[model samples]
Structure formats: C-alpha cells, structure tokens
Target: MPRILITGGCGFIGSSLASELLCLGYQVTVIDNLSRRGSELNLSRLLAMGAEFHKSDTCDPEALDKLNDSFSCLIECSAEPSVLSGAVGDGARSLLNVNLMGAVNSFEWARRRSVPVIFFSSSRVYPYDRLNACHYRETETRFEFVDGCSGVTQAGVSVSMPLDGVRSLYGASKLSAELILREYALQYGLPAIINRCGVVAGPWQMAREDQGVFTFWAARHYFRLPLQYIGFGGNGHQVRDLLHIQDLVDLVVRQVAALRDRPSDFRGDIYNAGGSIRSSLSLREATEICRRLTGHEVSTASRIEARPSDVIWYVTDNGPTGKVFGWEPKRSAEVVLQDIVAWIKDNASLLKEILV
Candidate 1:
C-alpha cells in the first residue's frame, strides 16, 4: 500500500477520507492545524485509528517543510471552505492564506519531490452571479431550472458553466489555487488532479452557519435549536446537491489508483464530484428529513435578505466525472441524512461542547 499524506486531515472530508484509506490498508498521515472547533476530537480519532498526525498549519510553508516527504501522494484538502468567509475583519487575509497560500506551499513541496497530488477544489469556483442569473422556477420546496437555461440541465450545472461573475473571496481563492495547480501540472509535470466538489456531508462534520450547512441543519434539528430559512423569500427553496463523504472517498480511491496504475488514462484534470440530481435537497426538504430522523422539531423562521454571492440553486452535473472516472454517488440523500443524524446522536455530549 502506498503511503499518503492528507492536509486538513482532521476536517470532515479529509478525516473521513483518512479513515477510509486506513481501512483499505494505506499508510496514512494527517496534518491539521486543529484551529476549527471539534478538530482536536477528530485528531484524536484519527490517532486512535493508527494515523500519524502532525499538528501544524499548512499556511506556513515552514510547518509543512518539517514533514518528511516520503509519502507516495499528497491529498491537499486544507482550506477556508466558507463562501461567507473573508467578508469581515481578518477573515479576508485568513481565507487567502489558508486556501491559496496553503495550496501553493503544498504544490511547492510536491514540485520539489515530483510527487503526485490530489487537489480538492470546490463548485464555488463557478461564478456566483452567473449561477444566480440562471433561469429557474421556485417551487413549493425548491428551485428547478427552467427550460432553455444555458449551462444548466435537469441533471445539473456542468463545468461548461460560465466563470465570469463574482464568486466570493473564498471561491476566488480556490479558483486561483486551481489555476496554479494547472500551471504546475503543465510546467513542472506534476501528476495533479483537481476535483471541484459540491456539498460534502457525513459524520464528524462540525457544521456552522457559513460552512457545512447540511450537518449544521441536522445538528440544529437534533439539538432543537432555532432554525431559519434565510433569503429567496425565506421559502427555503434554495437547492444544492449533497455528496456523502463515503461516496467521495470511493471516487478518490479510484482516482488515486488510476493515477498510480495508468497515469495516462486520467484524461481531464478537473471533474465536478457531487450527487447530481440524485441527492439534491432543498432546505425545506432537509428540515423535514431532519425532523423525521431526529424525532425533534423546531420552528424555522424566515428572512428575506440573502447572503452575498449565495446562489438560489446548484446541483452538480457529474456527467463528465462519471464518463472520466466511471463513478457515481452510491449514497442517497436519505442515507446521508441518516448517517449524520446517527453520528450527532452518538456524540451529542461532545458536540454540545463545540456546536452549541
């Protein structure tokens, strides 16, 4: 088995991937800053599972330089993932440093060693204004794309979608990183692959208002906390596709194997990894599901003011991903919700320390 290093490995997606890779007999090492809430707990879990961990910030190239570069692959998952990030105070600097500079340092390390890298990008790289301008109809529970909408279909938004408008600071940082990765791949001959992923949800996600909305909503319902349907007339019609961490790991494993075994076969450098229409969920629908799963109900208020750069609807079109990787999400929305609900229930005591 190949030894792998995962930056941000204590994060929801990164930690989940680490667990899966370890189970598959890969020698995994995780490096995380432990800055986020519940990250220490996640780190402990990874350590107990036999994953070597380095408590350091990826933004500091010096910190990353201290690590041994003996790993076969680097999974660069470190980032300030909130779209609402960088809107205030030092957030702007933090977002850029973590999402862009952190990636740069990682790429530099990989470049020096000629190591392969798997970069985890985001769907937010697509323009926010263009996505908002998409033709769509508001239904009772969610928004559906109207016929003749360019760059959109019943399946969802494709990579061909325009990248012309404001994509928020967070998105801009990730997009910038993706561009850098492309340059590195071409100029340095780095074996790099980028996956512009959608909403990734599953156990151990310390969801907050700005990021990890899926787990946040589930936790709110489980804890009987106040919930709200903000923006879009507060109808909770905004839609997004949810990708379970397990399914994401499956695709990642396959990608790593393909890159290792048949590098030439990895045609495209970028793929939109998500649930497509199969796991799409509206806020209203998600609330209902959480209610059922947790056996708890809390009144959800409505607010008319939408967040900056927030889109009304987004479902990833995984067509290109499936064609290139022969992979599709195996987990449904219900199953994803059930797993989150169960995790929250099991860790309610610990979660209250951080989530509440």
Candidate 2:
C-alpha cells in the first residue's frame, strides 16, 4: 500500500478521507493546524485509528518544508472553508493568507518533490454574481435552476460556467488557487486534480453556517436549536446540492488508485465533485426532513435581507465528471439528512456545545 499525506487532515472532509484510507490499509499521515472547532477531536480520532498527525499550518511555508515523507501524493484540503469567511472585520486578509498563499506553499512543496497534488477546491470559484444572475424560478417549496441559462442546465451548473463578475472573498481565494495550480501543473508538470466540490454533509462536521449548510441545517434541527432562513425572501428557498462525505471519499479512493495504476492517464485536470440533483434540497424541504427524522420543529425565523455573498440557486453538473471518474453520488437527499440526524443523536451532548 502507498503512503498518503493529507494537509488539514483533521477537518471534516480530510479526517473523513483519512479514516476511509486507513480502513483501506493505506499508510495515512495528516498535518493540521487544529484551528477549526472539533479539529482536535478529529485529530484524536485519526490518531487512535492508526493515522499519523503533525501540528502544521498551511499559511507557513516552513511548516511544509520541515515535513519530509515518502508519500504517494499530497492531498491539499486546508482552507478557510467558509463562503462568508471574509465578509466582516479582519477576515479578508486572513482568508487570503490561509487559502491562496497557503495553496501556493503547498504547490511549491509538491513541485520540489515531484509529487502529485489532489486539491479539494470549491464550487464557489464560479463567481458569486454570475450564479445569482443565473436564470432561476422560485417554486412554492424552493428555488430551482431553469434550463437554457448560459453555463447552466436544468440538471445544474456545469464546468463551462463563465468566471466573470464579483465573487465572495472566500470564493476569490479558492479561484486564485485554482488558476495558480493550473499554472504549476503546466509549467512544472505537476500531476494535479482539482475537485470543486459543493456542500458536503455527514457526521462530525462542526461548521454551522456558510460552507457546510446542510450539516448546519441538520444540526440546528436535531438539537431543536433556533433556525433562521436568512436569504431569498426569508423562505429558505436558496439552494445547493449536498454530497455525502463518504461519496467524496469513494471518489478520492478511485482517484488515488488511478494515479497509482494509470499515471499516464492522470493528466492534471479539474472536476466537479457534486451531489447533483439526485441529492439536493431547499431549506423548506430540509426542515420537513429534519422534522420527520429528529422529531423536532425547532424555532424558525425568517429574514428578508439576503446576504450579498449568498446565491438563490446553484447545483454542480456532475455529467462531465462521470466520464472521467465513472462516479455519481448514490445517497439521496433524505438519506443524507438521515445520516446527519443519526450522527447528531449519537453525539448530541458533545456536539451541542459546538453546534448550538
């Protein structure tokens, strides 16, 4: 088995991926700053499960320099990981340092070692304003994307989407990293794979807003916590596709296998790791599901003012992706919610302090 190195391995996705890889009998080593809530817990969990960990921050290039290992590839998952991250106060500069510059450091390390980079990018890179301006229709239950929108289909937003206009600071950072990574792949011949993923939800996710909207929604409902529909006429009609963490792990597992067995075919490229329409839901729909599963209505509030950084409707078109990875999310929207509810039930006491 090949050794795998994951930056930000204590994060929701990274930790989950590490867990899967460990189970598959891969030698997994992870580096994380342990800054995010529940990161320490994730680190501890990974450590107990036969994964190695080091306290490292991606913002510091020296941190990457000090680490030397014979690994198959570097999985760069470290980021600010929130769409609203830089919207207020001093978060803008911090977001850039952690997201953009941090990625620069990661690419440099990979370039020096001639190691491939498996980047966990974001769907937010597709320009915020363009997504908001996409042709959409508001159904009674939720907002839906309409067909014939340039760069979009009834299925969802495709990779061909234009990259014009303003985007959230978090999105800008991710997009900048993507462009730079592409250059590195071209100039340095780095084997790179960029997964511009959407909302990923499952157990052990600590985020309650912006990035992991599905997890946030599920946690709020499970705990009977206060819930607010903050945008899109306060109806919770704003939408995004939800990918299960395991589905993403399965995708990466195949990717790593491909990189090992078929290196020639692994020419650097980007793909959308999305849940697609099969596993998507609106806040209104989410509330009903959570209500049914958790048996809690929770306090609900509505806000008419929409966040400038937020979109009314967006879903990743996984059509082109399947041609490459032969992958599609098998979990349904309700099944995703059910898994979240189950995770919360199992760890309600510990999660309440972080989630509520």
Question: lDDT: which candidate is best?
Answer: 1
What TM-score, over all chains together, does every model reach? 0.97, 0.97
lDDT of 2: 0.85
Error of 1 at 283 (Å): 0.3
Q: What C-alpha lDDT values do all the predictions have?
A: 0.88, 0.85
Regions of model 2 farther than 4 Å from truth? none
C-alpha lDDT of residue 252 in model 2: 93
lDDT (10s digit) by residue, model 1, range 178-226: 9999898887778888999999999999888889998999989888899
Q: How well does model 1 score by local distance difference test? A: 0.88
What are the runs in model 1 whose C-alpha is more than 4 Å off? 264-268
